[model samples]
Target: MKATKITAIDFFDDLSSPYARKRFFVGFIVFGGLCIVAMYLDHQFVPNGAIKAVLDSVLANLLSSILVILGFYILYTFFIGPNDGLKEVVPTRARDISEAMKQLPEKTRSYLFWGRSGSYFRSSPLIVLDGYARRSKIMTNVDVLMPDPFDERLINSYRDIKDSLGEESDGNPLLANVLATTICCAVLNANNRYLSVRVFYSAFLPAFRVDLSDNGSILTQDDKSKGALFFKPSSEFHELLRTSILNEMAVSREINLEEATFKKKKLDSGSCTPEILARFGVAEAARSALAPKIATLIEERRHRYT
Candidate 1:
C-alpha cells in the first residue's frame, strides 16, 4: 500500500465542500469560546443591577455581531466562492514574467525569443534560461531572432519605434548589448553542455516581442508601461506565434558564437571600427561611438557571467 500525503490544500478543499462537518464544528467551538469570554466580561465589568442588565445587553449585541460576521464569512467561503472585488479593471494573462513562468511546466525544453534588440533578453529572459539550465538534465535549445544591423530599413524601423516611445538611441547600445549577449551565450553554452543558444540576425523588425516555450508564450513590447501578455498552449494565437517565430529564425543569419572572435580590447575601445564589428556579426552600418560605455555596461554586470 502507498502512503498518502496530507496537505493544507486538501483541508481547504474539504472546507469548501458541502460535507465540511469538521470546519463547521471548528467554527462552532470558536463561537462558543467567544461567548464565554463575553459572558465573563459582562459579569466582571458591571454591578448586579439595571446597569448590569444594560451591560449584558451590550455584550449580547457585540457577541451577536461577531457571530453574524463569522457566519457570513463561512457561508461566503464555503458556498459563494471567492469574491473578485480586488481583480484588475482590465485583466491580463499574468501580472508579470515571474507569475507567467510559474504557469509553465517544469519539463519545457525549448524556448524561442523574437524581438527588435537584445536589451529585453539581457534584462529578463536570460534569467529564465539560467534557471532552467540549473535543474534540467535534458538538452535545452534556445533560438533568438533580431533584425540584421546592416539592413538600414529594419534598423530605421527599430529606431523609429524606440523614438516613438521616447527611447531615442541610434541603435549603438542595442548592437553592443547584442554583442555582449552573444559573448555571454557563448560562455554559457560552452560551460553547460545541455544548453544550446542560437542567435539569428534577420532583415525584419517585429511589431512586438514574443517569447515561446513548449507549453506557453509571453508577448511584450519596448514600452514597459504596457505590461506583458501570456498565452497558454490552448490559445489559438500560441501556435501561430510559434510558427511565425520559427519561420523567421529558419532563414535568418545565424552567428557562430564559438568561432566568432571576442576581443575585450576591441569591445572596450572608445570607437568600434566597421571592420571590428563586421567580424563579430555586427552590422557595418552600426555606429562606432559609445563602445567604451557599452563595454562598461557589459563588464560591470554581464561580464561576470562570461
Candidate 2:
C-alpha cells in the first residue's frame, strides 16, 4: 500500500461532490442560443436615423462613465497601494502569549497541549513546558495532550501533509501512518521520561497557546481589528479556556468506543476510561479525580512564590 499523493487539487476536490460537468455543457449551449438570437435581431432591425442617434448617444455616455470610473479606480489604487500593506496592525502586548499562560493556576498550567494545526503548535510554546518536561520526573503537575495516532481523526486531520512525508505508511500492515508515527514516536520518547501524556481523537478548540489549565488564558486577535490589546487572563478568559477544554474532552469521550478508539488500550474499558481521562485532564467527570489534587498544587505554588 502507498500514501495517496496530496496536491492543492487533491485537498480541494470534494471527495463526495456530485458530478457537475454536465451543467457546464448546458451553459455553453444556452450561451450559443443567446448569441444567435442577438445576431438575428441585429439583422431584423435596420436602425433608422432617429434610432441611430439615440444609440450613439447612449454609447457615448456609457463610454464616458466607464472611463471616469476607471480613472478614479486607478488613482485610488496608486495612492493607496503603499499604505495598504501597513493597514493591518497586530496588537503589541506588554508580554508575549506565553506570559499570559503563566497567569493560569500554576499546577494545571504546565501541561502543553495541541489542537487543530499540529504544524502551528510546532511554532510556539512556553519555556517551562518546552524543556522542563524532559528534565523533571513525572512531577504531579506535568501533563501533555496529543492526538491518538490510530484514531481516524488523527490521520484525516493531517492528511494534507502525507505528500510531504514521502509515502503513506497506512497502506501496509507493518507500516504505520507517517505523521501519526512521528507523533507516536514523540509520545513514546516523552513517556520514557515519565512525562504524563494523554492522546485524543481530536481537539475541542484551536490552540493559540499551550497552557491547558482550567485557570489558563487564550489570546484572540482578529485580522480585521487593528491595535487590539493583549492582556492577562480575566475571569471570562479563564472560563473560555476551561469550557473549551471540557467540551473537547467530553466529545472525545462521547465518541463511541468502536468509532473513536484507535487501539484497545487499558483505558478503553468503562471503569478505566474515566480515571484515565481525569488523570489526563477532562474537567467535569475528571473533577473528582484531580481537582483537589490540582487545588493543592496551586496552594503549594502560592506558598513557594511567597
Candidate 3:
C-alpha cells in the first residue's frame, strides 16, 4: 500500500549477489591466525651478541622502509582524501544516456525522465515498456516529459538538430512514433491503479535529458555519442537535477490520456484509431501522416514479443 524506501545501501546492494558473508568471516579468521603466528615467531627469535646487533639493524631498516612507504601513502591520501568515498560511487563516465541509465538501480520508489520525443526511453534496453509496466504494477510513480510533438516549430528545430548530428532527418516520423509511445503509456496508466504514469508536454525543449530514479540521477546530452554525467542520491549535483526537473514539471502542461486505448484487436488490425490521436490533440491533417508511423511502431513491438 505504501511506497518502498530506497537508500544508498539498498541501491548499492546487489539483490542477488553470489558472494557469501561466511567467506569474509573465514578470511578474517585466517588473517588473525597469521598475525598470531608472526608474533609468536618474533618472540621466540630474540637473538644475542652479533646476531642480536645484525637483527636489530635489519629491524631498524625494515621499520625505516615501512615509515617511508607510509609517508608516501599519507601524502597520496592527503591529495586524494577529498574524493575518498565519492569516486567509488561515481563511475568514470557513461558513454551515453543508455549507459548512464544502466548505472541506476532497477527498483525505485519514483522514476522521472524528461527528454525529446521519448525516443531514448522508448528504445532503451534499461527502460523497456514491459519492465515499465511491471514497475507500474508495483506502484512506482513514473513521469514522462517531452516537447509537444504537435508544435510544428519545435519539431522542425528538433529535426534540424538531429540532421546536424547525422541522425534521422524526418521529424514527422519521429513525432508519430512519439505519439504511438504515448498511447502505450496511456494503456499502462489505465491498467494500473496507483501513481503509475503521467505525460507532460512542454512548449520548449531542453538541451539535455534528465533521468531521476530512487537510486540516483543521470544527465545526458541530446546527442547519444556525447558522454553523460551521473550523481548519487545524496550529492549536490543529484539534488540540483531533481529540483530543476520538478520546477520544469510545475510549468509544463500535463495531458489527459484517459480516452487512449490499445486493444489486442487494434494491434492485429495494425491501426491506431483517430479517437486516440484526438485525445492526444493531434491535428486532423497530421493524423494521416502519423497513422503509418504509429502502425510501424506497433508492428515492431509485436515482432519483439512474438
Candidate 4:
C-alpha cells in the first residue's frame, strides 16, 4: 500500500497518552517553580556591590557545574545504560526487533534486523540488503537516522571499517568509498520527492549512506539507481507487523492479551473517563478519528497496486 502522510500530531498522539502528558506537565511545573525560587534566593541573599558580584560568580560556576554533570548523566543513561534491566528504554525496542526478525525467513530476516550499539547519539539502523557492493564479507549498510548531528564515535566507527578487514588494507580506500557510496544511496533512497539524503548535511558536514541498490554497484550511473531497490515498507505493513509481534510476545509470556488490547483502546480514547477508573490514562482520540481516513488510503493503495 502507498504510505500515508504522518503528521506530527499523529505520531505524538500514538506515542503519548494523557497520563504521560500530566506527568510531563507536573514535572515541568515543579522544575520551573524551583528555578524561580533559585533566582529569588540569588537576589535576596546577596548584599550588593563587590560582595554580590563574587556571590554571582560562585553561583554561576555552581550552576554551570551542575548542568554539565546532569548532561553527562543523561547521555550515559541513554547510551551505555544496562541493557538487561527494566530501566533500559532503547534495549526494549532492540529486543522487540530481534524477536520480530526471528519470525521471518533466514535470508529476509537479516534484511529487517539490526542491533543498536551502546552509543545512543551515534547509533544508526543496520540492515543487510540483498545486493550491495562489498570489498569484504560484510554486505550490509548503516543508515544513521539519529535526529542529532554525527559525533566522534560514528566517525571512528567508519574509520574502523578499514581495520576490520585485516589484510585488505587499501590505505583507507574503503572509508572514502563507503562514505561516498552511503551518501549516494541515502540521497537516492529519500522518501520525499524534492529532498534527497545528500541534503541531510551541508557540504562541509559528514553524511550517512545505506545500501539502496540490489547487489552493491557503487559506480553505476542510471536514471533509477539500483540503490532505489531497498524497499520502504508502507505504514500499514509496519503497524500490522508491530501489532502481530506484540501480541505473539505477550502470548508467549502467558499474559492476558485482552488486557493489553483494552489498554491500547483506553489510550486511543483519550483517557477522559476510562471504562474502569483504575485504568484511566491519556488517550489518543486523534488516532481513532484518523483511522477511517487511513483505512481508506490503504484500501485505495492496495487496489491501485494490485
Local distance difference test values of all predictions, in order: 0.61, 0.36, 0.60, 0.30
Instruction: Supply candidate 4's per-residue lDDT for 251.
Output: 33
RMSD of each: 10.7, 20.2, 11.8, 25.5
Q: Estimate the TM-score of every prediction.
A: 0.60, 0.32, 0.62, 0.19
Model 3 agreement with the true structure over 1-306: per-residue lDDT tens digits:
112222222322321111222343355456555645554565578655786566556655655655565465446546643332433234322333444575453767577887776655544522343465475566667778888887888888888877887766764634775676576666656655544677888887778777788778877776544555667786767777788777888898887867335433333224466666776777887767667668667556521101
lDDT of 1 by residue, 196-297 (tens): 788888878778777678867877766655666666665556788899988898898997865334323322332234454555755444435534545565
Model 4 stretches astray by more than 4 angstroms: 1-58, 61-68, 71-109, 112-133, 137-306
Weakest 10 consecutive residues of candidate 4 by summed lDDT: 114-123
How far out, in Å, is residue 40 in model 4?
Answer: 21
**Number of clashes recorded per candidate:** 0, 1, 0, 13
Per residue, candidate 2 scores C-alpha lDDT tens digits across 30-106 of: 65555455545544684658765665565556556555654664465466532312212112232233334344434
Which residue pairs clash within candidate 3?
A: none
As for lDDT, the candidate ahead, 2 or 3, is 3
Q: What value does the lDDT take at residue 172 in candidate 2? A: 21
TM-score leader: 3
lDDT of 4 by residue, 235-302 (tens): 33343433433343333221111233223232111322222222221134433433343223222322
